[model samples]
Target: MRLSAEHAHLIRAQALELAGAQARVRLYGSRLHDHLRGGDVDLLLELPSLPANPALLAAQLAGRVSRALHGRKVDVLIDAPGLKQLPIHQIARSQGVLL
Candidate 1:
């Protein structure tokens, strides 16, 4: 992964703070490739239960994580019990590394 240990820790801390302790986070996309450079952070946040507002939660998490990373671009995808799974979600799970 492209993230430093500190960056990964910040991501995990922020995610668990917002989504609760049971939430799991994964890092995927270009950031996963060491040979790649200057790509946005792509995260898959798996929640044990559905959030009341998935979109808002995603945006909030993304914003907070971005700010924590010194304004680096961050994209978050949420997967939860009641939400419909998309192809991207499958790809993420397959390619992602746990954070």
Candidate 2:
């Protein structure tokens, strides 16, 4: 993966800072393939293991990261505990870089 440690740290830290320390973030998609070029950053964010409005929490987290990574198109997918599995989430979890 070409994702810099700084960016990864920022991604994870931003989730912790804006949301909570419990958020688990992963990076997936083209960014993961060194052979590929110029694609938006794809992120799968597992919401903090807490009780809250998952959708709103996801939007908040995505907004913070989007701002932090200015000029980059970021696609953030959120997963809540016990929620039904989505294929994207499965792919990300299996192959993505854990931020």
Candidate 3:
């Protein structure tokens, strides 16, 4: 993983705070590969439920991540219950490394 210890710690902590204790986080995309470089952190947050204003929540999470990373890009994808199934979601959950 390309993430520094601080990065990983902040990510998990932020996920817990943004979602809940029961929430699970996964790391995916180019950042997960050692040979790859200069890509944003791709995170999958599996939550029991989703907020009504998910875009606002995502933006808030982005702000938190940006502060921690000192402006580095972070992509947060929420996997909420009862959402319409999509192939991208399947790929993310299946291929992503659980954190």
Candidate 4:
């Protein structure tokens, strides 16, 4: 993963803070490849239960994480018990590095 230890910790911390301790975080996309440069952070947050407002939660998590990362672009995808699993979610889970 391209993220520094501090960044990874921040992301995991923020995700858990908003989504609960049971949530799982993964890092995906170009940043996963060390050879790649200047890619935005791609994160998949897997939740144990569905949130009342998934979209709002996603936005809040993304905004908080992005600010924590010094304004770096952060893309957050959410996976919950009842939410539809998109292809991107599959790709992320398959290729993502757990953080």
lDDT of each: 0.95, 0.80, 0.81, 0.93
Q: Can you give the TM-score per candidate against the true fold? A: 0.97, 0.84, 0.88, 0.96
lDDT of 3 by residue, 21-52 (tens): 98888888888888987988788778888667
- Candidate 2: tens digits of C-alpha lDDT, residues 1-99: 868888899889877775676778899999999889888888888774643666676677677777877867788777777766789889999999888
lDDT of 1 at 42: 96
Q: Supply every candidate's count of residue pairs whose N, Cα or C atoms clash at under 3 angstroms.
A: 0, 0, 0, 0
**TM-score-better candidate, 2 vs 4:** 4
After TM-score superposition, the amount by which residue 97's alpha carbon in candidate 3 deviates from its true location, in angstroms, is 1.6
- Candidate 2 wrong stretches, greater than 4 Å: 48-51
Which candidate should be chosen as best, given lDDT against the real structure?
1
Q: What TM-score does model 3 achieve against the real structure?
A: 0.88
Q: CA lDDT of 27 in candidate 2?
A: 93
Judge candidate 2 against the unseen true structure and give its global Cα lDDT, from 0 to 1. Answer: 0.80
User: 32-60 in candidate 1: lDDT tens per residue?
Assistant: 99998899999999999999999998999
The local lDDT score (0 to 100) that residue 38 gets in candidate 1 is 98
